[model samples]
Target: MADPKPALVLHLATGGEPLLFALTTEESGKLAGKLAQLVKTGAVESVTTKDDSVVAVNFAHVAAAYIDDLARKSTVFGMHA
Candidate 1:
């Protein structure tokens, strides 16, 4: 068998914003479509990535939201980006 295909994960948001996720990738085309919808609806920001770096289109908003989200989750030691 060949190696699994790398996911085409688009950046959603980062910096511990609430209700945000890292390198978002849906399992199927259907899920991808839904994700695109979310982006269009302002539920998430568009992320562009190159190599290991990620950039968020709505950085300030996303940063605040993510920080809040991580505090609430409190899975700091358990989760890795």
Candidate 2:
């Protein structure tokens, strides 16, 4: 029998536009469960897959702060690269 296609996992953080961070995925469901557990600790946007790669982004208060800071930093740096 043919094998099932791998799924890309993604975790969306709260506060901003819900950015999906690339996470790892496998045939087993352990990673998905783990992601759920983490999301329970804070406001999680969603869980998704793309191109057969798991993606997970932490959406805690610290995550929001970091994203904001990162945006500011990028703006300051400009689109050089």
Candidate 3:
């Protein structure tokens, strides 16, 4: 079998549940860089949730973003893009 893909879990500063996203290791890293760029350039208006929803998260609202290596074993549970 092929290697499993990586996944990421984002924790927002808001008083709600955390958000989970399935992405390759490269993608996750790229997102981190992109977030940093957004923070610096203020180029992003909103972010798209992995669950097909749009959320408006400014730099201040981003509490943290983590790469969930353990959860990488599971891939979208039969869902698609």
Candidate 4:
């Protein structure tokens, strides 16, 4: 079976709910880099999620962004196994 894809998680500064975009590890890395650049410029950018939905993100409003690689099995205490 193929491995599960990772998700790109974005937390906004407005402090509501976070945005999630499913993608592969490589794609997540690429997007993360792009977000970093956008954040530096405080630009508004559009990102395509796994569902093929386009989301417009304002970099100035983004607090944090990361990849959620769910394939990594975790222990009871949330430590990677």
> What lDDT does each candidate get?
0.36, 0.36, 0.53, 0.71
lDDT of 4 by residue, 1-81 (tens): 458777777778888777767875656766866767787777887776667677787888788776676566752335246
The CA root-mean-square deviation of candidate 4, after full C-alpha superposition on the true structure, stands at 4.1
| Cα-based TM-score, every candidate | 0.26, 0.29, 0.45, 0.66
Best candidate per TM-score, number? 4
User: Where does candidate 1 clash, by residue pair?
Assistant: 16-66, 16-67, 17-65, 17-66, 17-67, 18-65, 18-66
Q: Please write out the lDDT profile of model 1 over residues 1-81, one tens digit for every residue.
A: 443332333333543423433332222232344544444555644443324455444433331222212223334434424
lDDT of 1 at 4: 30
The most accurate candidate by lDDT is: 4
Q: Which of candidates 3 and 4 is the stronger one according to lDDT?
A: 4
Residue-wise lDDT of candidate 3 within 1-81, one digit each (tens)?
556544555556664666665565656566665665554554444544445455554555656555555433453433222
* Residue pair clashes in candidate 3: none
What residue pairs are clashing in model 2? 8-49, 8-53, 9-53, 9-54, 9-55, 10-55, 22-55, 23-54, 23-55
Misplaced by over 4 Å in model 3 are: 32-57, 72-81
Model 3, clash count? 0
